[model samples]
Target chain A: MSRGTLALCAAGLLAAILYPLVVRGLAGAGVGVSANYLINVGMLVFFVAFIGQSWNIAGGFAGQTSFGHVVFFGTGAYCSTILHVTHGWNPWLAWPVATAAGALVGWAIGALAFRAGLKGSYFALITLAFAEVFRILANSVEFTRGGLGMLIKADQRPENFQFRDPMWIYYLALALCVVSLAIAWQLTRGRFGARLVAIRENEDAARALGIDVYTEKVKVLALSGAMCAAGGTFYAQKYLYIDPSIAFGVDKSVEMLLVSMVGGAGTVFGPLVGSLVLTAINEGTRSLASVVPALKNVQPLSLIVYGAMLILIVARLPDGLMGLFGRRKSGKRHDA
Target chain B: MLEVRGLSKAFGGLKAVDDATLDVRQGEIVALIGPNGAGKTTLFAAIAGFHTPDAGRVTLEGHDITGLAPHRICAAGMVRTFQITQPFAKIDVRENVMVGAWLRTGERAEAMRRAEAVARQVGMGDQLDQLGADLTVAGRKRLELARALATGPKLLLLDEVMAGLNPTEIAEIVDVIRAIRDSGVTILLIEHVMQAVTSLAEQVYVLNQGRMISHGTPAEIAADPAVVEAYLGHGAAARLARGAAHA
Candidate 1:
């Protein structure tokens, strides 16, 4: 790592650590519910970034683009929720179990799809199908209370994995983001990551070079799934509610993918930056809709803007938003 | 160090490789030479574990490796390069080689050092910083060789590695490959370049219409009627023989 990147990372970390405190200070200065809203927005950025990193791991780094990552997310959310609300297991205990369940789903899907010689679009569609299957199952299942959804008991105690203050949740999201960033960082530096990049570039070539493409694909998917599932659990805890639509929705899948691809897919900070930009756009449009009398209740404006931005990102900024910043030197070729 | 016996693989109704038998003894360079559609590559794939042979067996260092995955076959001490170059376009040449080097060592620095050495060995040291996609055709071919070599394979399979190379480049690669064999790696190459085959390979196997036609020293294969008929049309060998007799 270069000194510049190291210093930049340190600055970013410091800013992230101080974000909540600054918001709290602003609130102390007599800001209204908007201040608390800003805090929530910050939390959303990190939370989305965390799950986005999960998508980035398999889709971006390994070139196994999945359209149904929500399968894992839903699996995580349902697993923990079922355990906590129905089985009477604590959320803290259920978190790890949910994460493992997510990973198992990832492994099963990857193994089946890859072993069947699926790649690119076929692989993607299969993942989407899996998510849909899970969604239908969740809706029809009795333990999940079907379409009624499962709601965790509202107990505002840290011991119960519920907190009275939203700020504590924001801090938790920050920690998850930091950990995810560290994983992405390790990918750029570690042997496993190099193998993934190899597979992404060309799978047959990677296999010819002694990489087990099936094994690596499965491994990365599980890792990504585990991370996403953990995010689902945190999301459930934050809302104290998880329904089929919320847990296994295509919206979360798209959000995760958009944040990663729009920011930068393979890079560590891409999803984080994407989350920030997207959440800002979402909230900014919401506030705009509030102020504008004619456009009141028109939440779809953000979707229109979002659609336009996605097109632009796909067409002009093929490398994602991070390309505007700078390329990682290690990823660049040195000329003879 | 590698032996293949009665290896056969078919794609749909087409028999890509039919009862092909070849071997590479310890520290020897063997060439599999045939005309296009002769199934030389299919045979290579079967031996290297990309295509599971419908029949027969592949053994490396006295251990049966038939039906193993490519990586497992590589771990068992054999690796193959692609006919069309497959380079990791996003990564630099050194990093490309390191993906293969990581097979030998898990340590990044060690893999880096080892990858550099392999690159230099294949005369790609100066281009180590260049991305895989940026390389010229000859460079890509060499990169393929470098990557396979980095795995420290006991037996190396070269699938048409000199297909697009000029004579000068081919000669240079020939020397590099010769040095590799001298350094104790066995080689099984598929080549149409007769100059390279005659110069580098000690044993030559000829394939025609998905079957192994003949195996011998390059000179012997050249003189054989079956080998000549395979390369030319039917009875071209007889005409050549008659022409030679008339001469």
Candidate 2:
């Protein structure tokens, strides 16, 4: 490992060792379990980061920006929710099914869109339109509970992956978050990573160097889609609810992009920092609104905050915050 | 050896390349020269498999490569470089070259080693860690050559590499191409600078109005009426030759 990689691993180990104690200590005090709740929120934030990181494989790394990733998330959620509610299936069983479904959808998209020569901004638009169409379809479909939405009954079952305690959900999400980071690290280090970077830089040049651009691109897209779909399964089991607006919404995709952009799109550790920072701000806004009744009337402040953060990060620090600390001459300094 | 037969391409009603045929022997340096818009670039593209010809057959040695993808063609022991450099601007120079080296070995460490060696060969070793976007035009051109070389190509198609270089840089690149040819790589160069062509091309092919106007030694092509009329216009070849002689 390089010195940089060693330092990052050490820092991550330190954080992992300290985070649980911090949560337990806060729970000991009269902080009303806010720390625990925030930790739970952190899991969601990290989940968003994972989506962002996965999205980068196709969007940032392959130079194909996709705004329809939430479709996979929705599909996973619906698949798991229906299996558990209607057929009494275990969440574990639903996980692989959801992943396969996601991969299939991704392959279909790649075959159609790439073969037709859709790329760049045009690809982004097509993905966005696809997500919107899925959202509309989910809202109209009766099996998805339509506008009534799907809600789980209040229960505690370890096998079902449902509990009254949010801590269990937190641990599960934390595990997924770590796995996502590991996958992202592997991707950016391996030969496949180099191919993606080459294609992103120049497709024609990559093709002339014997890199199969279409096959590599589709493979990355499938990986990204599967990751997002798995996240959807986690989301459904944790919250015990699925709604068209929450599950298939375009805003979810935007949130993923925001976290990735804020962290550093092509960099390995960018999404982690972005998730931590954004989640803290998000939780802080909710707590402040509870304390200050005047802020209760402000419904969309979190979104406004997200938008402003994206703009500020893009304008002042185009390379993201970590880039400011890295050595500039190395050109490994995150500029994008 | 490389062979092309009945190569024809058209844009709407106008033919860009009309039933062109050519062959390049092993270790030979072939120059393709033509007036502007005579379809030299187009023909190169077709040969490289970027464009599917209206009707043609291309073969490397005895292996047919008709309608194959560009990457597939590259894997068959050929690579190409563009007139406009297409370096991976966001990455280091070595990493840009590594993209090509990955074609052969597909092992990161070995590819990187080869990339560095090729960078040094192309006179870019000191700038290995430099961002490709930050390089000067000449540096970018060298990076392009380095990348093409890193692919372990047996046949290299170079398009307008000398277009914007000064006289000194042009001479340096000419020397590099000669070295590459000496290293057992057959080269097909599309060049406008006659001086480099005259110095390096083992055989010259001149195209005009999408047809081969002449094909011979540098001295013979200089005397061909159609090649001269296509380039220097009527009665100008003699004066250009005198100018060359004086210089």
Number of the top-ranking candidate, with DockQ as the measure: 2
Distance from true position, residue A160, model 2, in Å? Answer: 2.3
Q: What is each candidate's DockQ, to 2 decimals?
A: 0.58, 0.60
lDDT of 1 by residue, A50-71 (tens): 9999999999999899999999
Q: Interface Cα RMSD per model, in Å?
A: 3.4, 3.6
> What are the models' TM-scores?
0.96, 0.94
Q: What are the Cα lDDT values of the candidates? A: 0.91, 0.82
Q: Best candidate, lDDT-wise?
A: 1
Pairs that collide in candidate 1 are A334-B129, B1-B25
lDDT of 1: 0.91
Q: lDDT per residue, candidate 1, B3-46, as tens digits?
A: 78888999999999998888789989999999999998888888
